[model samples]
Target: MRSPTPPDEPRFVLAARHMVETGQWLLPHRGSELYAEKPPTFMWIQAGTYKLLGSWNLSFLLPSLLAALLTLWLTWDMARRLWNPRVARYAVLALFVTLQFGLMAKRAQIDMVLVGMTTLALWGLVRHLLLGPSWGALALAAFAAGVGTVTKGVGFLPLLMLVPWVIWRWRHPQAAGPGRSWKWWLLLPAFLAGTAVWLAPLGIALLQNPDPALQSYAKELLFKQTGTRYANAWHHHQPFWYYLQVMFTLWVPGSLLFPWLVPAWWRRCRRADPRYLLLLGWALLVLVFFSASPGKREVYILPMLPALAVAAAPLLPGLLRRTGVRWVLMLYALLLSLATLVVGYGAVHGDGWAQRNAVKRAIDPWVLPQVGWWLIGFAVATLLVIAVLRLRRAGLAVVLTTVLLWCMYGLGAMPALDPYSSASRVMDQVRERIGPDAELGMVAWREQNLLQTWPQATDFGFKRPVAGQWEDAARWVAQAPERRWLFVLDKVMSPCADRSQVIDIGSANRNNWQLLPGTALQADCVARTHGVVDDADAALQDDGD
Candidate 1:
């Protein structure tokens, strides 16, 4: 709870909270505006957790953790089925220690859950296509893919696994195939059934209510967020080789083995090993599929990790004994420890680099130095473990070092960084300056601002333009000038707002905020009323009902 919620994390949790509060689960809202950027399957799980536990702090992140564990379990079981128990263990360990996969599992992000569903889908396909022609497994896999699609819009990526499966099955005619061509058609209904969990409810709700805004929300969610996003992404544009960089860095020690694994995989694939042909082939397809897209993110290809692990699992026993691989593991751990120590030294001494970082991150002067000491101590401990264990046990040392690093950061640094990153400290200042009785209105706010002060604060609108929000916010303050205040981003404060009358609320989440009293509104200054919508009034009306 103390750790900062990434910008998207708060947006998702807030939408889920709204779902629970309004008893309207079909459509999710982000501060009165429809949050149609994503389908609501993931939020349904989050909101379900909130309803069951009645604790946002505990419930919001549980889904990601569970999904991560599910991914590991599927990886382990699939490897065991394909090879042996030893390979299974290696595959799970390889995935668990992966920098990106482990990090996602620890957060409240949708990607991890989507990865879990996709991995499940892949696992079922492996069982049905590679191992046998089990209609039940194929159906289940299709359903999982459908569920995954609604979860993140790319869930159907697993269905692409069939492309490689068909080729491999054709090449090796004696192996299990998709089985009896007609049986494949039955899987469509299963996929629809999974999608219906969300779409079906949504269809019924729209029929019953039929609001134009809701209809627009449905269109944007179904079409733009999926097809348009893939066809022409507006942001996060990168070159084709972006994911290649991601694999090399973010995949870490496991990725370090790629040089050797590549040739070994080629040899096995050439020899027509079904396990390698299916797993490796599907993994390659995933990589190519994502790389072909214009929009790229490190997490977008996360589902491919399980396939990579399983493909590499059989060779791990031999790969681990290689002196070159062991040395790489040992050196990587040592360099990581040294880097932490050096950073800690700089932070503790209050060097220019450290101070600049602290300033940008809005970290407290005292907090950085305190976090520094912990990092220094942890790094020292890591060094001792590395020295004692040495190269022969390099794998163990690296795993231990990685685990310790996460523990130190999660247990020590996250809480210390939370106040600034989560905007709680700024919100605290707002509360202290105005006292509990004052009404707070938000303008040009981010998710954390509203999430931190929800029900206590009224947001103009998340999707509305800044000018429109400002106009609404100004009007709102005019009604109760004495008791009402506007908490606004520094960049968005109107030109007419009297600076002398505003209280600087300090920085949080890399943005400046100020507590603006209604008296700060200049007498001659007119609110930018163009393109304004009275969403604040509509949201208030909904709340009243």
Candidate 2:
């Protein structure tokens, strides 16, 4: 569907194709379809990047690097304003080590962009509320929020956060002042114009194709995926504390540091800025919004984490000022460091963490990073302890915590990037095995077109296969006896190890989806098993393959 398939970013690949082909953002292609492609904003920028840089290989990494750097800078500034430089440093520290945040940075999803927008919103709101609304701050805040609307739906989040705080300020003249002249009002037009300008292209494209799949994915990702979160799915369900539990397990470093370093006033901090209240409201409103949806995934709540993490950072010094509880914080960091080692080692060394015999499954790929910097993370923890040692009083502890914050992020969290790039390796392997004239098949997953990026990708023995399932694969194989077949599956979906005759050229583990033992490819945890199952007689279920 496009040139330069961003092996890790199939969505961006499709979008880039549309951008280069039509010189526009809006396209009538619905993703998650049978050969369906939707035009999105990623390609518009990615295409521009390719032109300026003359390389598509940097696609995923470049944007991620930018997101990270900006996040660090913005977070530092944000923490400084919320607390002392001490708390700000520690707050930024905790944010850096968030694993989910790192993962989001590398994907082609608009969510990372949300991170940037959210940060800018915080900065602008802080300026508007703390220092009084100068035109610059209001305009910046407006621009950021407006962009968020175009990028991810449920635009009411920021409103939930900022509006109430503004009202609070309006009601309390002693605590707040009416911001500068009508200049803040100018932001509304800028917000509308900026958002429309970027999204207008995609809108135009949709009007042209009018494909149902496009409408469906758009509706689901924008409204259902973003708007609603069902407590129960057919197979996967969780308790009300589901998001809370997920965060505890996944957002390791932050969980350890948040309770000890943050202050208490942040609970109703809207008195300071209509914007701070707006940020909190933005995050929580989305939380309640998801609770009402029928379809839910852990990622549905991703946007909320950044705000909470940033907000929590400002409290570290306040918590430390309370006395003996600071030791509890150190203990938590120690426990976290150990947990990271266990999970990291399990993923890198375990014999396919989920193995139940012939119909085996993989849990490791879903678990670990390839090369962890345990030593570095621990060193950062040590810094936190040292910082605590230097603290003679609450105020001193606050100062120490702030410096250690960013130190922790750099050491503890930044190394686990690049796990998604594993797919690029699978694309290479599949291309090497498949040859000219082989047709590809689409089965279970969403990243099918990811394979098409490689120059040799088109020469295939399979039908340009991507994310196909057992049933769909069996049907494709049955229709044409001559073309070879390869099916890709995540551990839960298809346990290839359970079969007696299947040949595994790569690892069976689907978690982290790396190549077989000894090799270094992270794509598709692919396996190729050929046999003489009569094409006509082969079943489409588990028993068939």
Candidate 3:
């Protein structure tokens, strides 16, 4: 079985799959305009992979893995240039084990690719700062910025790191090479070229079509989405301190080190250490930028995590030796071990314990057999922590614990959680019941659901005639000559109460759905209009009788 599709994965996968299947280079989602939202670089990459692998799941996940590997390698290379070999290795491990980075890397999302591109851009800029401005490094930095801008609007945000770089360079004019003449300005054109390669064609096409929908899409993507998000946001609106809350949870054990590391790094920043200043500036700029936005998500600040890891690498040896830090590590390990034991007990005892525990209640009863393996994995992690604590190997303890937890999550928890998290199972049911070629429609269901589940169905794009009502869908089906199926929330089935015409197939993702025979829809229409019949016509019929 395919692993479950996460929240937005289906959208990206279906959009790219459509492009490949229909030979439409533009992304045409059900609700959104063609080519609306972020540029399709990530989707295009997924489409290329799907062509090669013939597996949607593999194609969706491959880019994230590749981007993660690239980020890790780039982090190590950059660390080595700034510090020693030991620090470089630590930087790589720290980045790989960071909870947010690890989780983001395993999913099919544009965020990881955006993070990778921006990291590359930062690396190029840093190289120029350290080794003097070279044509190749400047060009690479500019190109990465442009490509990133197209990937996600925030991709170019990392280019702000150059401000600190320039200030530092000017302060130490000896470090600023004479080559920094007009050549430095070439970066802007390089950025424009990278973005134009993707946007120019689409812009020309939009000019030719000029459909209101297309124009609205371009306007929304280019202006409204960003402006509305920053001002009076439409979604995910939170206080300005939202990222501050996310940092505590998302960064995990890596963030545990931040309390001690940030202060020391701040001291270095004051001393004008160019390396510290560059990394500090990058992380702060990203954090403040996202924090200032009215709309926020935890993953928006992912680009900063690698910079934080690199900034902390030099301090690891010293921090690891602190007694206070070791105590904190031990406490964290102990809490994790206890949590694992509780899960094991719940898994073994079933619903009795699950009734009392919120975490255990969420696990599907069928997956309890896998709980033994999870216990064993957590046991090994706990033992490693004890051994490392005794041996005073703090770095080893952190790395091994992170690896064990990551493995348990990937191998154990993910499989158990798949049914609850992904729509793949629901999609499978649809395929089995309707057959691949059957036309299907959606009523108040997300566009992602229909496209991901039944991409082959011809009736995929029927819009609701009225908001929050299935009457439009009923009317559409009534007018059609062939039978049709609709996926809708179970709560919305009141309008289709007549069981004879609307046959309930089954329910998935907490939504009820049914197949509507075109012939029976006329009856449903009459049933819905029962209260509107004229009383005079009924009296005339009685007089005739």
Per-residue lDDT for 1-545 in model 3, tens only? 34535456766776788778877766455333254656678888889899999988678889998999999998998899889889999899888877899999988888999999999988887787666556678778888988888887777877898778778777887764434478878788888977886788778978799688777877877786556656776667789898877888788777777789889998999998988998998788788888887778888999998888888899988888898887776666666667777766666666445434424324345566475458656766677676656636656766777777777777776776565456445556666776665666665454445555545543323332222234555666666536566655444443434556676655444444565544444536645654332222222111000
How far out, in Å, is residue 239 in model 1? 0.5
- Per-model TM-score on C-alpha atoms: 0.95, 0.64, 0.87
- Tens-place lDDT digits, model 1, residues 215-288: 99999989988888778986678899999999999999899999999999999989988888878888888888
Q: Tens-digit lDDT track for model 2 on 1-545?
A: 11222233554554465455556445422132222222244445676776678665566346655766687678778667665687667666666657677666655555676667666766776666656645677677777777766655533245445555656667766775445476757667867765774566546656776888656655654544333423333324555557767667667546555454334436546245443565566666777766655545566576676567667765654565665555554554445555555544544454333122212322134333333344334445545654566434433333344334444444443333222223444444555554555554433323433334333221112222332334345444456535544433333223332344232433221322211111111123323422222231222111000
Which structure among the candidates has the greatest lDDT?
1
lDDT of each: 0.84, 0.49, 0.70
Please list the Cα RMSD from the true structure of every candidate, rounded to 1 decimal place.
4.0, 8.9, 7.7
**Which segments of candidate 3 are over 4 A away from where they belong?**
31-35, 176-179, 352-364, 371-376, 379-381, 388-391, 431-438, 451-455, 458-472, 479-482, 494-520, 523-545
Question: Model 1 off-target regions past 4 Å?
Answer: 1-4, 522-524, 528-545
Worst-scoring 10-residue span by lDDT in model 2: 536-545
Q: To one decimal, what is the Cα RMSD in angstroms of model 3 from the true structure? A: 7.7
Steric collisions counted per model = 0, 58, 1
